[model samples]
Target: MGEKGECSGVKPSDDEIWAKLVPSDSRYSDVEIRSDEKVICSEISAAFGDKHSWCKIIRNSDLCSATVENKSPNTILVDGTEVHNENTVVIKDGSEIIPGPDKGGFVSYRFDILSSPETSQRQLQICVDVENAKCSICLNIWHDVVTVAPCLHNFCNGCFSEWLRRSQEKRSSVLCPQCRGVVQFVGKNHFLRTIAEDMLKADSSLRRSDEEVALLDTYSSVRSNLVIGSGKKNCRKRAHTPVDDQSDGTYLQCPQCVHEVGGFHCNNNTVHLQCQACGGMMPSRLGFNIPQYCSGCDRSFCGAYWHALGVTGSGPYPICSQDTLKPISEHSISRIPLLAHENNVHEQNITDSCIRQMGKTLQDVVSEWIVKLNNKEIDVTRLALNHVETINARTSVCCDCYQKLVSFLLYWFRISIPKYRLPPEASAREDCWYGYACRTQHHSEEHARKRNHVCRPTRGSNM
Candidate 1:
C-alpha cells in the first residue's frame, strides 16, 4: 500500500533508537560532584614551568578538576579551539548522547559562562547534545517524536498521515514531503505510534530508575555525612581536660582518662589543645591560627589542628606543626648537552665536491680507473651528473630530434648511457625495434669498449 500523490516525511526520537541499540543494564558514566567541594584548580604556571606544565591534579586535594572539556560551552572560543577530552565538555544537556541524521551524537552539559566567568552563575544554562547525534529514522529530538518517511524527511505524524491519505488517490507511491515526487514508504500512523511507544517506554524506565537511585544514593551519602558529624562531635567532647588538676599553666590533662594527655591549654589570649605525651594537637573551641600537639609519648598524634589551619596555605606538616614530616632530600637536575654544534666544514668539503662534478663528464673516469668511495662499483653519481640535463630534456624534446640532438649532446659531454628510458604506455605496447633506440645502445657499448671502463664508486656518489 503506497500513498498516492502524497508527500512522505517522519522523524523519530533518540530514545526510540537507543531502545533497541543500547543494553538495558548499562549504567551511563557521569561526573560525580559533591556540594562541599574542597579543591581549587589553579591556573597553568606557564611562566614558571619549563615544559608541559599542565598537571592532572594540584594542591593537597585529589578531587578537584580543571580541564578544557569540562568548561562551559558558550564559554567556547569562537576561534574554534577544540577542547579535547571526554567528560570535559562544555555542552549543557548533561547527557553524553549526540544524534544526527546519519547516526550518533553525544550530548554534553555547558553553561554560557566562558565569556563572563565571574557572572556565569547569573546567565542562562544551555546543553549541547554531542554523542551519536543522529537518527535518519527519527527526527532526532528526545523531546518530540516525528515520523521518518522512506524519503528521509522528518515531519509530524498527524500531518504526514493526512498527506499520505491524500497522495494515494492520485499516484502509486508517496511523493517526498518537500519534493512531492513518488518516493517509498506507505504513510501510516502505526509506525509513528510504535516509535513513540518505544521512546516512552525507554524514557519512562530511565526516569524512574534515576529518581529511585538518586534518592537512595542521597540517603546513603547523608548517612555517611551524619557519621562524620557524629565523629567530629565526639572528638570535641573528648578534646577537653581540667585546668584545676594542673598546678602550672604549662600543662593540661584529658578529661576522659584524667591523663596528662594533650588537652586544651590556655595562653594569655589564645587556646590550643595539645597532647603533652605524644604531641597530638587540636584547635581550641575558640579561634584560628592556634597550634597544639598531643603530649602522648608513643602513639602517633591524631590531627585535630586542621580546624585552626589557615585556608590560604597548606596545612603545617607534623615536624613543623605536629603531624606532618618534611622530605629528607630534594630533587636536582643537570643540563649537559650530549651533542656539540660545529660547522663541520671539513666533512662538508667532501660533500660539496659532488656539486662541482655536476654538468661535467667523467674527466677522471674517461682517463683512469676509479676506486670505491661509499660502496657501489658503478660511477652512478658521475653518470647522473653528466646525463642530468639530457635526461631532463628527454621528456620535452621532439621525437625526431631525440636521436641526433641527444646523441650529439652526449658525445660532446662524454656521458655514459645507463638505461633505456622508453616513453610511457609506448614501452608497454611496443619497443623501438629498428630506429634510434637500437643505435643508442650500440653507441653506449662502443663508448664503453673504447674507455675499457670498469665501473667504480667515487666521493659524493649517490646510487
Candidate 2:
C-alpha cells in the first residue's frame, strides 16, 4: 500500500489533471494523474512509473469520469467488480479500486477528483443572437463580417466593400448600410467572423453556395481596420462669399472648381474624395499618376495631392500639411505607438523596457526593422493593411497607418531577439499559452506580466 498525497493549494489548468489516486496504505506514494491516459503499477511514481503495465486509466472526453482497463493478467476489481484483462470499467470520483480480486494483502486506492472540468477550464462564453450575426446588406449569415463605426453596424465585407465603392463614386460621404450614421471607421471583425462561422456550422442550411461565396470574395476589398474619415461630410461646401452671377449655392466646389490646376478642372460630374484629416475635397483621380488615396488604409488624404499642386490650407478650402501623409520612408516614430502589441499595455511596456535595456532608441530600432521590411526580408502576412503586398518604403500612408506599420515592424523586432538577449526579468517569464492571441492578456495584469505574449500561440485557432 502507498501513502496518499495531500491536496495542494494551487490548482492545475484544463490541460492538466484534476484528479489523483490516494492509496489506502502509507507505504506507497499517491499517484497524481497529469495526462489524459495514465497507467498505474507497483513502481509508485507520480509520472509513468508503471513498468509492469498493471492497468491503464483513461480520462474520458468529458474530463469528469475515467475508465480503468486491465492490462496485466492480475485480478483488478473496480468497485468490487472484476476487470478482466483487456476489459475496462467506468470510474468516478470516490470510486475504489483494488489491485487484487479481494482487498486482503492487496493495495486499494480511492480516486478523488479535486475540481470539475467546468470549474478548471477558463473560458468566457458570450451568448450572441444568431440573427444578429447576419449581415444586413446580404441578409445572410455574415460572410467575412466587417464592422463600421459610429453606428457600430456590421455587414459582409464584400457587400460593404461594393457598397463603399459605389458610395464613393456617387457621394463623398459613406453611410452605414443599416444605419444612416456617417461611417468614421471600418474593419474586419474577426470575433464576429468566428461567430458567423460557428453559426453556419451549426446550421448548414443557412450557408450560401460556393459560387456565391466566391463572387462575394471577389468584391471584398477591405483587408484591415480603416479610418474612413473625420466623420464630416466629404462633399465640397460652397465658400461663404458674396453670391456672384457665376456662383450657385447648390453645387459644391474644390480647388479645381474655381480654376484649372494640373491641366484639369472639376466638372459637375467629377467625383470627389474628402480628406480624412482636414475634411477638404479633391477630385477622385483613379488612373492619374498623383497619389490621392493612402495605399495602406485606402483613405483619401489631401496632403500629398495638395502638395503636388502646390496648394496650401486657406479659408473654407482647407488643405493639410505635407507631413500629414507621406511615403513610409519619410515617417518616423519617437516612442512606441499605442496600437502596438494589439494595444496590450503590458506587452507594450515589456517591449519598451526591452528596447531601453538594449540601449537603443525606439526610432533607431524602427529604422533598422523598416529596412528589413523594405528589403522583403520580413513577412507582411500579419500586417493589417490593404494592398499589403504592394506596400514598401515608397508607399504613401497616413499618420494613423504609419503607426500601424511601425507597430507591425516592432512585433518582428521583439520576436527576433534571442531569449538570452532579453532583459533578465523579461527572459525569466514563461510564454503565455495563447501568445499574442490571448484575450486574457488584455484584462489580467498579473497573467500578462507573468507570461510572454510576443511568441506564437501554443494552442487555439490562433496557432
Candidate 3:
C-alpha cells in the first residue's frame, strides 16, 4: 500500500508548475532584459555545462514579465536559490540569473526591460518618388519650390519669378500660370524643397547641372515672404509697385509694402514675421511694445498685432481672433482643464473642491502663483516649455501655450505643500499603488485622484 501511494503521487506538468511559480524577489536592477523569445548565454553554457538549453526564458502572462526556467539537471540558481530541472522562476526587470551551481563555474545573464513598442521595433528607410517631386513649370525636380495660394499650384522659384516678371510687364495683374486667377499670396515651401533634395540625393541623375542651378538661383524671387497686391479686373490701370520692389526678388513687406499702415510704410529691408494663425505679415517691431511672436513656438500671431495697430480685419487682408493671443494679465480661467492632474478627473475634482472650500477662485489661485513665478520665489529650473530660459510672465504666449505653463505651475504648487496643510478631505486619503504610472488614470478619473500617487515602496515591503 505504501509503495503504491508513492508511485501514484501526482507530478505537476512543467507548464502547470511554471504557471504558479512567480519570482520571490521581483525587483531587478542593473540588468538588461531582451525582447527575443529566448536569449541563451553561450559563454555560460560553455563554461558550466551543455552549450544549449542551459537557461531559457519566455513571456509569462501570469506575471506579465519574463521567467527563467532550468532545462538541465546539472544545476541552476536564480539569485541564491537552486532551481532543479523543470522548475521555473519568474525574472524581474534588471534581475540576474546564473546558469551553473555557485560553487564551481557559472555564467550570469542580466534581464532588461523594453519600455515601449516603438523601442522594440527596428527602424526602416522610407522611399519616395522623384517624378512626383518635379515642378510643373520647369518639368524638373523643384529648385526651391514655392506655393501660390488660391490656385494651390506649385512651381520652381526661378520659373514662377520669370513668369511673374513677364506678366507684370505685359498685363495689369499677376496671375497664376496654370489658372489665370490673380495670385493673392506666394511663399517658399520649405517642406517641399526638403523632399525634392532627398529625391535628388536618392537619384543623382535627376539633379540639374551647376550652371542651370546657378541661373535658377539668380531668377529666384520668392525670398522670405511676398504679399501680392490686389489687381483690378475692370480698371486697365497699372498700379505703381512699392518703392525698391524689383521683379523676381525676395523681400519682407507687410500691408505697408504698398500702402501706409498705422502711419508707417514698409521699406525694402523691413524685417517681417508671417502670422502662423492667419498667414498675414507684420513688421518685426520690438520697440512697438506689443507681442507679435510667441515666445514658446517663435510663431507670429495676429491677435496682439492688430490690437496694437488699432485696426481690425475689415481691411484687404485677414486678421486673427483676439482670443488667440493676449497679455498674461488679460487671460483668465474659471474651470481647470480636464487634462490637469494627468487627466485624473477625480484628482482634478478634489483639487477644485479644495480650492472652493478655501473660499478662493481658480483665477485667484493662479494669479497669486503667477506673482510668485515672476518674483523668482519658485524654481523654474524644470519648466517644460520651449525657450524655458527666456519665458516668464512678461513673455506673451498663445492660449494653448499659456495653459501648459499654468498646468506645470499648478503641479509644483500641489506637490510642494505639506499633506497636513491640505484640506481635511484630501489629507485622509491613501496613495495609490501605481501613482503617476497608473493606467486607470486615463480612463477612471475617480481612481486617479482618490488616492495619493507620489509614494515609493517602503523598505521590507516583501518581508
Q: Highest TM-score: which candidate? A: 2
User: Per-residue CA lDDT of candidate 2, range 1-463, in tens?
Assistant: 3312332322434564456775666354557776677766564344654445567787787666889988768778899899888899999877888876678766688786545335444334567787888888879999988898768899999999898888767775677889777776677788888888977887899999999999999998665455443223334366544212123222245688667888988664444666778776776765677778788877778888888887777645768888878998898888899989877887788789889988999988988988888789999989999888888888989899999999999899999889988878789887865688766556545556767988888755566
Off by over 4 Å in 1: 1-150, 186-463
Q: Model 1 over residues 150-172: C-alpha lDDT tens digits?
A: 44554434344345445445444
Q: Superposing all C-alpha atoms, what RMSD in Å does each candidate have to the true structure?
A: 39.3, 12.7, 14.7
Q: Residue 8, candidate 1: how far off, in angstroms?
A: 61
The TM-score obtained by model 1 is 0.15
Residue 137 displacement in candidate 2 (angstroms): 14
Q: What local lDDT score does residue 441 receive in model 1, on the 0 to 100 scale?
A: 22
lDDT of 2: 0.74
Query: Model 2, stretches more than 4 Å misplaced?
Result: 1-252, 357-359
Q: Rank the candidates by lDDT, best first.
A: 2, 3, 1
TM-score of each: 0.15, 0.54, 0.48
Q: Model 2, residue 129: what's the lDDT?
A: 85
Model 3 lDDT per residue over 126-206, tens place: 566766777778899999899987787888999998987677567666789877777766777878887788778778999
Candidate 1 lDDT for residue 85:
26
